[model samples]
Target: MTIPGGELFDNRDGEGRLRVGVLISGSGTNLQALIDACERHEINATVAVVVSNKHDAFGLERARKAGIPAVFVDRTAYTTISAYNHAIAEALDDHAVELVVMAGYMRLLGQEVLHAFPGRVMNLHPALLPAFPGASGIKEAFDYGAKVTGVTVHFADEHFDRGPVIAQEVVRIAEDDTVATLEAKIHAVEHGLIVEAVGLFADGRLEIDGRKVRVLPER
Candidate 1:
């Protein structure tokens, strides 16, 4: 649970707002949420960059439309996962990112990216983690007949969806709900929770200790 050399960034002086680099691999719903929050000034951070593993990801187009710097780091071009992650880390660093948010980023990040960002990287998972950790989380919950499922926003560790929990929002699964229905509800919660968590982070209201997250009172 211990993140190596975890030092929280200081935003008290307001020299500049937190700069966030978002990574996505799909439709980018959550990416859109963050961008909207930044535009509305609901969060004190800006989307400094957006990187995608796939060149044709719709998220890249979203970023470009927002006028944010977007990069495509293809994993197939790299010989190893570590190399690809190193390139991702370099891209984030190049933008002077203070935080990295993974929204529908399918690839499991390597140790290089984890070490490079330390406690700075965050990810949103469809299911309440430690329950369904891998892909197709909504389908997993539906197959298992779970009555209630939720969304989890957590730090990005070397493992998949195994990082410390930051925030979570629960959603009820009705008996009539199919996988798609459940996924839709999950996405709704994911968008709102991610925006809220990013605002808390930008305001320096989040304190991480081990696997626990403390939301301090706003200043």
Candidate 2:
């Protein structure tokens, strides 16, 4: 299968698998979710590598424990954002990464990285986006006194959480819900939605039409 731009869609060998590369900054709960799905064969994708912008990120430990190749490409060591993003793209290519997933990855990706991977990059945001975006979305939602919040899995674009949403799972914000409680709910939805969206992408069940996403039934 192929898209209009000559991009391969649903192209796989006889094994019917997709290779994934995960980027992380802190705890790798979503990465763990993907790993679990792959282990159980619940998704047709495999985590090929885990990359981190922080050297001491706990996600690195998680990846190592899972016997996956973990790399530290510290952004602080680079002089500019573009330099760091270039290095990241190189690392992903070195690992032959097919799809790039940002899970708890705190850094804002540069245009270089976005263009390098194009439609192959995905990200999990802790809020139903176009609402609360950025680093502290959960806290922002709680402070704003929103009655509902959720997680969004979207294709990564140059802008912050403004990409085309692939999937979303809503979580009700109770009247008594504090920042911590809201964050917990956000995390739960993030983990589940990310895995589900990745599964759809792996199975060639996702299509992007302008700013909208179309999910097709599995063949």
Candidate 3:
């Protein structure tokens, strides 16, 4: 995975909160978690906007209810992936987004957005990444008879689910647990771990050194 190389200035808003743009594709349970965290002041940030490629995504409704701007950039309207991604980047930039979080977004970000945000992009995966990647991670882990699977929050790179891991929490698979149960367990962990990664980034505690990430002490 190639890291998008560029320096990004601190784009905190006047209230000293990081401005976040979250991209989602589905129900956006994770998006809700981030919104809740911001509301509760668990993180020093605010969700400025939510972007979705699918117009009917429930995440858009979630964003609307939160009073955050919800944008649907129709992929069908663009001929090339780069064009679609560029539109997404434009939307984030319009909101003064400091951090881009791919909560449940289905598409891989292109260079247009990557170059714009660089190390400021993050993603949450269902299984311990570099392991079961892709849309069906929870099912793959269950079918593989893995005893322990977990959630991973990492910096987004060019490839899918391949980037510097920021944090992970393990979920033990029980003998009685089915794929559905395992998925539930994974999502529960995801909600917390993703928020933790975002909080670390918001506080300037994450330092990416090659494939490694160092979580610095709080000031």
How many clashes in each structure? 0, 0, 0
| Residue 69 displacement in candidate 3 (angstroms) | 0.2
Please, what is the whole-model Cα lDDT of each candidate in the order they appear? 0.86, 0.84, 0.90
Q: Point out the worst 10-residue segment of candidate 3 by lDDT.
A: 1-10
Sequence-dependent TM-score of model 2: 0.92
Clashing pairs in 3: none
Query: Which is better, 2 or 3, measured by TM-score?
Result: 3
Clash tally for model 2: 0
What TM-score, computed on C-alpha atoms, does each candidate reach? 0.92, 0.92, 0.95
**On residues 1-219, what C-alpha lDDT tens digit does candidate 3 reach at each position?**
232222233567766888899999999999999999999999888999999999999999999999999999999999999999999999999999988999989988898998998888999999998999999999999999999999999988899999899998999999999998998898999999988988888777788889898888776
State the lDDT of candidate 2 residue by residue for 1-219, as single tens digits: 221111253444246578789999998989999999888999888888999988888999989998999999977889988998999998887877778999999878888778888788899999889999998888888889888889999999888888898898889999888888788878877877888988888877888888888887657
Better of 2 and 3 by lDDT: 3
Candidate No. with top lDDT: 3
